[model samples]
Target: MEITDLTPAELRVWRAFPLNEGVDLRESADDDPADGASWGPGRTVRAEVLRALLLDGPTTGGRVPGLKLTGARVTGRLDLMYGTVDPAMRLRSCHFEKPPNLYGAQVRALVLSDSVLPGLTAGTLRVGIVLRMTGCRVTGPVRLAGAQLSGALFLDGAVLGVPGARSGRPPGPEREDSGERPEPALQLNHATVGTDVWAVGLTAHGRVRMDGATVGGLVNLDDAELHDPDGLALEAETLSVGTDLRAARLRARGMVNLSGATIPRRLVLSSARLSTPAGQALRASVSTIGELWLRGTAPVQGAVNLRGAQLDLLEAAPEVWPERVRIDGLTYRRLSPHLPAERRLPLLEREETGHLPYAYEQLATAYRAAGDEVGARTVQLAKLRRHRRTLPPYARLWGYVQDVTVGYGFRPMRAAGWLLVLLLTGTLAFARERPRPLKADEAPDFNPVFYTLDLLLPIIGFGQEAAFAPRGVHQWLAYLLIVTGWILATTTAAGVTRALSRQ
Candidate 1:
């Protein structure tokens, strides 16, 4: 390749290489690299040549402190560890010979759009503005541990891969011998982004970790493809996102762990796909979010654990719910309008050992607040029945009695209905053959209705039974009436007490 064959854009970078000043590669004011940025292989920029230029102080003339080496093929690793580069590095549409080592480097804004690198070791890298990378390809892992970005960390439409990609490696990509989980394809462990961490249309072939990272804006991964098969694909534990954590249309191969994450806004996973056979597909245990929407999304093969999560609402279809999602401690105020308690209660029936009673209690409370007392009682009854299975034999029997008699104290009217049936049966049975008067001087005749009432009402007894004792079949009938009264009275009291306490 000769210099004369270089394009205008290539020639500009060649001419500006010696100045060490940050160069803007945009040829025209209306130019867009995302559309496509063309590059030529006419010249190759060595690592030492660029390093010398970057290490030197500013010239006597007024010049920007940043370094820009766009549209050039560089040979050798760019090591800027512990070095202070006064200006931003906008290396767009460039190819690196080796990974750039910027461990603990300080710079202004950092942009590496439309470039190719072997890997990146940017641990503790501090950027004043943004650390943005878009439309780039990296063969190895990209680490950003302890990094602090004043602006967003954009890796949109980038293709990231893991070098060795062993079955079960340790964290941070450096420990391949430990045999733990593989390091994230794009690691941001404890990195704080002032704005967003936009990776829309990203294709990563390893774990994506943002543990303890704080994003002031959204963490959008819409249409992103991530895979780690036997391990976690996305681990954002303890992450704090100020706005939405949108991952619509995301296709993740393994578990997506967001345990203890805090998102003040919503977590939109509409149409997203996540699958993990070994364990939970999505673990948001103890995470706090405004809302979670999984509308029309792909079903997860494994459990989606949301234990201890606090959210404003949950939007998910019943049929599309995961096989075993643990919502034991999920504190959500509302379900989607399409998913009333009648439809959504089944999803809470996860946790193979049986769901926690509080889970059902919370859902019933939500239904109750929505002016659906019947629905609330329905959920409450289910909770009681499910919880009964976990109790001792005696308690379970009691729960059964309560359920059949008064719907576990939810149907006090059932108890009253039984009382009315007993009263009617006794009155009608005794009316056929009234008890004969034992005393001839008895002034009042035996009233069948009053006599039946006296036998049925256990709280009060009348002298009718003592005055005229029944014979044979009638004697047995009287015994039956007395037992019926006792059963009704006891159950009615229990039901009334339960109802009053519920209120």
Candidate 2:
């Protein structure tokens, strides 16, 4: 590039690139390039000059090459598609006239901290070092699809997809509509990052997608706000992470999808306030995580679908529980707070979704593993009651009888109580009237207590029932005693057998 063709700012950048020296044009630290209209020709650097320097600029003998500039206006398109740049590029506190296109390009390090860009298009770009965009304000989508980064990808305190208020520049096109479907504000689909993804305090107006992306280290999104009212706010389906996916204190306005993802470590969402009315708030179905933490004060407005999810531990708070949830095939080895079965039973009692007998059984198993026999029994009894609601009228009637008499085999003491009550009633009734002896020579002594015992115990013979014959009301009383005894004994046996099978 000719020296006459470059502006004063571009000349400075050109002189500093080979020696890795930084060029700051701002008179003061507070002088931002947001008001690019105020910048004269001296502060304007053509994008062609930058591309020229990156591709075939003069090289220093041994000094490291870099392009570090601050507080300038970048004009025209800085298109470096499919090119390989060796220098580290750091453009802090700068304003871009157009979005830099680095599609399929390979670079060393790229840092654009506290800068204002219309958008970014770095799809399939490969970075040898870090890609930091902390405190940046972008007005459109930041596409990084299929990008391979050897170091961390930082977006801490960055704001994207918002209109340019102070810059007076028109915001980038919100969507590149193709086949009627809009693209996401931040797309990292199928990207591979060697280290962590630090996105703390990130605010995006549209969906932030990371579908099928793989990260070697943790992905932290603490205190982030994602708003996509018409669609998903954060769609991370099949996102595999090596460490924890921590998103504590996150506020999302649409559904967050994590279906089919495999996070071997913890998936923490503590203190997240999610709202997606008429849709699911957090749909993590068919995912596998080491642990899932949802214990916080924030409320979730929509249903949570955890069907077919496998977790080692599910640590949740009752206050943050969603009103409706589908946990049909959710298998968690443990639950948090060690709450009683009664307190947790409501989770499985979503009658509008029909009976969840398997869910109740899972809860029972969890309680039993924790050595809470009473809690396990409580869960089992609840399961039976819920199942009874789905039975036919006659079957339900019989179920009611089993429930009242013995708690559907869960309350063994009820059977004993019934037996005591019947024994007392029969003894008192028989004592009031005595039956005549059938034969004076062969009959035993007329003992009312022994006679009542003989009539009530169907399997045993006390020699009193056969020896005496009762008449009138007393005869009818004997018949009633025999029938009642059989009913109680049979019910008690059936209940005991059922309870034993559960154990």
Structure candidate 2, residue pairs in collision: none
Regions more than 4 Å wrong, model 1: 1-41, 57-69, 162-177, 338-342, 353-355, 391-395, 460-468
Report the lDDT tens digits of candidate 2 across residue range 226-291: 888565889899999999998999989889899988889898898888898788999899999999
What value of lDDT does candidate 2 attain over all alpha carbons?
A: 0.85
Quote the lDDT for 138 in model 1: 82
How does model 1 score by TM-score?
Answer: 0.86
**What are the clashing pairs of model 1?**
66-87, 184-207
Superposed by TM-score, candidate 2 places the C-alpha of residue 279 at a distance from the truth, in angstroms, of 1.0
Give per-model TM-scores: 0.86, 0.92
Which residue ranges in model 2 land beyond 4 Å of their true spot?
A: 163-181, 435-457, 467-481
What is the total number of backbone clashes in candidate 1? Answer: 2
